[model samples]
Target: MSSHLLSRPLLLRHLPSLSFPLSNHRFRPRRLSSSAAVRPPATPEPAVSVAISADERYGKKQIISVTPQIYEYILSNVREPPILRELREETSSLRGSQMQVSPDQAQLLAMLVQILGARRCIEVGVYTGYSSLAVALVLPDSGILVACERDARCLEIAKKYYERAGVSHKVDVKHCLAVDALNSLIQKGEAGSYDYAFIDAEKRMYHEYFELLLKLVRIGGVIVVDNVLWHGNVSDPLVSDPRTISIRNFNKKLFEDKRINISMVPIGDGMTICRKVLQY
Candidate 1:
């Protein structure tokens, strides 16, 4: 069994000490648009290796976590796609580093799009555009993916990815706070138009995003939210961080939300997959 369950509880991870000063060791984004928490570049490890082992440290049956070979393959592909080699080099030159959707995650998203035959998609965060590319890759030529990105700096990187992947025609980038972008789209009669929506922007707005997404995504469409675990602190009662509490509360609400069928997967911090079951 895969030891690393995506739904597994999040734990605060510690980094190895190095000459890089403490402040320097911190994963600070060079720009505010770097929405993802930057981690140390992954060292090449054995293919399909264990990532997190569920041992008896807690005196219970453990789950052995493994990073699939596909993950490494995706990293390798991203590191070497020929057409976009120059664009990627420029992206790194501008962004200072690479942050992308793992190959497993990319394939997972793509499979969903293809299997569900999603012709329209909405993505809340564009980041380096990996997620958007993932969605667009499986879409029909007529499909459209609307991506909301507030940071022009990061969106620039995303644009390159879209171009390199030859999917720019399928993606429309909206530069604005996600909420405003969604509000305007709805105003323009884009409501209930999306077959799939992925939400991964600012955490505190998850609830609001859901409300807006519900209107924008048609009944029977699905909405996916990332980072619901917030690095394992969602259960810490004493910690009332707005983002964490908001997620925990959202999870609670989803469980009781008869309007949609939900499955919170333990994938990449956590992905709450909700398929709208009720027509508004």
Candidate 2:
């Protein structure tokens, strides 16, 4: 808790002087007797300080309430390169721009790719290639990203930006349903070949994608699922919408799943990270 909201001194300074009529007897303050003296004010609790960092790796459940001011502060301090910033600005005005991952989330994805020493990556949804661009930019010279997306219009925008970012050679854009692309990878003996996978496709198909991605990533490899909170609808029991139900059920299944070590991180739209610990 911060005194910035309303401090005692500030409150006292703004408070108006009061005078009451004799007729308002009920509203008069009651004086305490000597025997029933008022208790001394208790000591104030220490305020918890939070440090915002773009370079540091976040914990599994680490989260904070993101007010507009806090969001702005994060954007200001976060280290985003010029090419990435330009791409973000270009994608911000699209009709389905909301589908693009936040800059913080994109930065985290890029960091994860480097931290994991990932050489081959898979992106389940490629909405204007925001995430794809992020991951591709951080990858090594030999690194490659297989981006699976169904929307041609979005892919066109993503291709333009990818080329602009100079990562077009690294990203293999598959303009088809994510499931088909994932299955094709498996069929081509590419199972357990990838180091990381990012899932951000259709909500109803999360479970299906998770199963396929698990097989695609090798043991000890990481898979990050985005929008696990579904705009905080999964936790609200009253929200029985199709997407909400799908996300809720998907979360339950992930919890019960024993093949991987899971961490449901509270980041952009709530990302759930799963590390494959067993061989299929």
Candidate 3:
């Protein structure tokens, strides 16, 4: 096992927002230790929308602490293209402009896709294509990345970025509820055909996505869900925020799930990675 949190050096401040689309969302807590505890998501969506803890993806997870050198090394590996940089600026320039994915998380997304050798993949959300670009860059040349996003403005940015990245040919950006898109795919008997999937859309509907993802990904395939840490509120029994409660419950369910092997890593906010192991 790695060293304890106390054994680490002085952690640096968040990457100085080097890119236009970088953010430590409002749910972020501005304190740090060798280990950092994340804040949960507070965005209000339709009650019927997916019930994921959006804050958790953007919120920093309670880290047990890795060395500063380790942290820097991870950040240095993420590539930031000039076209993506310009798109980030354009999206953030809008009113109520709310599109951002940290550099580390985006790079991590790429790593996951490559490691999985993902071909048929899905992304529940695509904000400016940073996440889409990350995954698309690493997918096999013949791979297809289906991005389901509801916001046209965000999709516009995502499209622009993918085109700029020159991988637009490999991506399919659909404007619709992620669940709806999956349902349509299921109708075509596309379940269990995808090799990897990422969920970062409406938080409340996370459970729904997980259920469908299990069907879409074959055994040994993986489904990576973002934002399960929910900032620091998940552990607080008294914090009755519905979103926080939902995430807490999901984490519990994932652990008991004999269908997959799970790991809740302190990578970003908290990424719950489940490698499916069962049939059904």
Number of the predicted model whose lDDT against the real structure is largest: 2
Per-residue error for 280 in candidate 3, Å, reads 2.6
Candidate No. with top TM-score:
2
lDDT of 2: 0.78
Lowest summed lDDT window (length 10), candidate 2: 9-18
The better candidate by lDDT, 1 or 3, is 3
Model 1, 119-205: lDDT tens per residue?
999999887676687778779999999999888888887887788788899998999988998999899998988899988887878
Mark the regions of model 1 whose C-alpha exceeds 4 Å error after superposition.
Answer: 1-100
- Predictions in order: lDDT: 0.69, 0.78, 0.71
lDDT per residue as tens, model 3, 1-280: 1233323222222333233322322222124544654453497322222233347666654433445445555555556555555665565566534335556677677787788878889888776676778788888789999999999977887887788788998998889988889899899999889888888877778899999889988988888887776655676799988899888888898999999998886665577889989975
Ranking by TM-score: 2, 3, 1
Tell me the spans in candidate 3 whose CA falls farther than 4 Å from its real position.
1-16, 19-74, 88-99
